[model samples]
Target: MNGANHSSGNIIRLLQSASANAALYESGHLQVVRLGNQLFEELSALLEACGELSLIVVENELIIDGRPQEYSLFINRFTALLKARGVEYLKFQKGITRQEVASLVEFLSGAAGEPGEIASTGHLRFGYLTVAAGGPPSDSKGGERCAAEVLKELSLKELDRFTEIYRAVQRRQKLKVSGIADVVSGFVDLFRQEGAPLLILAALRDSDEYTFTHSANVCILNLAQAMALGIEGQQLKDIGVAAMLHDIGKLFVPEEIINKNGKLTDEEFDLIRQHPVRGARYLMDIPGVPRMAAICAYEHHAKFNLAGYPKLPPSWRLNLCSHLTMVSDFFDATRTRRSYREPLELDQITTMMLDMSGTELHPVLTRNFFQMLSDLKTPS
Candidate 1:
């Protein structure tokens, strides 16, 4: 078996043994210690498999190490025990101790009595194994950009909502920023605490769903880049909203053309090119939508070299947010999966972006953007 499968089996065994020990601990402390020692060894084995253990519960689903564990009797029991105590996520690093295992057992046994109790006794942080769930896990510098299950689920849901709202706006209905606002805030909160770089948790983009996923992923990328740029508050929120809705006009184009697996005719290509204007108009008509959003929607397709469609004045300077969104939109588009082709690798994408810096992208912003990506890739 592969290492992941082997490790997953070990995790199942660990959960089973831990749950059993927790249930039996009150009867005999010595027996519990022995069982807990076994559990500690199990964890050590799994830690040796992967660098760390990350457990997440989304509804009834349990995911470990970005892969879902197979469902079985023990998994069901494990889920029930955690839910009964309001525990939703867990993480463990190397060198976990036997005492920590024993404390975890006690916490799980008593946690059921407290409503929404996030952590176990002795004030053990969830990641540290006293076993409670609250806030984002403490971040380790240059760590993998894994996010909480709640945040991943929330981002997906918000993407769905954003797509629906875009359809409504395309139908000439007014846009509501309330749902979008909440999603941006949630993203900001998680980003600040988790320190995860954008696109880390993005789902693979299918051909038909490219617009929706791309919009959402661009927003995530944009938010991270913006945060790195020291942009904050209302401006940050506006940028996120705008980035997510950048391609809203694509909804006006025929789906067949968008999803075509072959080359497009000139007419079809022109219709494809009109999305920026169409999307910008949609946003401009909305009352609460910011002007920057409309401008970004309009100009996201416009080249930094002033060579793209919907030609503007040669001397016109685009908004800073527009420049940022343009880079973000291009990065996400090139990296998106499609029926016609696979997504590009990060090194290739970064190289391509850097090549386009002076004439097709903002030189300074592109430099900073790639630097941030490079920093994220280095081990801390």
Candidate 2:
């Protein structure tokens, strides 16, 4: 498996390929990985410090195991370099010859060139940060994002590792138990470091992609409701953990069921209903997952009207955190797309949620909840 293997049972019927056929192996070397003025230099220094890399591909992410400490510093340097050249990288990418690239690199490095006038080409080339593409532009695709720009923005924010971790989690056959805990830890740390509520809101609402972002958003909203109800400290963190994973059940649901194109049959609905129970079970295995976290997962779907699942013990009561989690969970879910149903616009989602407050979500938390995220979208 150390080599590229091509097979076509084309039943050569008459012809066969010879392993010894030098004629068959043209272009034997791997393609050169082009670098901008920045990444090229970083890669050079890193290669000089570390020997050959042990290439390991787990889906779309990369890990260079030999140089552990150097990796972080190299990534940081690469990120800064990319950010400095962000928009420029996306602006001029076509008919760019090798000499042109070299000239551009020299200009970026501030060497001895009177800056030549760049003709507006109306097309930009891309670097390959996009996992879908191999980090570089293939043939020019109109209006496609430049991979370098995306990497540059992420580098500025110091979020490359987060993106890497998230993609890695998504690629695994299943999310690892340890991985989920690690991510949830990162979420809590962000909350702790945040001094302003606006920062927390922006961190959730802006920049983050759909799935993980939505999950973290709901958890933050749920945590706010906890504070309004006077929950504090470790108790608050416990509830945050539960809210973060309210949908762990969906991870186990078939992609078809989760992405269903339209209304589901009663049988399909039944399968969907099993997620709350499933999610609670998965969270139960994690070490130190408080009873509050597990219980919220178990009962977040159970209604205040007593119309939801795992019918409460004769006296099994829902509490502040559980009720709040239910509200935030649905709020983000409605704003998101589904297989059978397209997602509602934000205003439409809010209006519908407003209508269901007292009966479904807790009335007071629902009221404070709207206000909690009200200052959210306004520019700081």
RMSD for each model, in Å, please?
20.3, 22.7
lDDT for every model? 0.68, 0.49
Per-residue CA lDDT of candidate 1, range 204-290, in tens? Answer: 343245666676667877887666554556667888888877877888898899889999999999999999999898788878887
List TM-scores for all candidates, in order. 0.59, 0.50
What TM-score does model 1 achieve against the real structure?
A: 0.59
Which pairs clash in the backbone of model 1?
A: 118-132, 118-133, 119-132
Q: Which ten residues in a row have the lowest lDDT in candidate 2?
A: 5-14
Candidate 2 lDDT score relative to the true structure: 0.49
Best prediction by lDDT: 1
Give the distance in Å from residue 138's predicted Cα in candidate 2 to where it truly belongs.
44
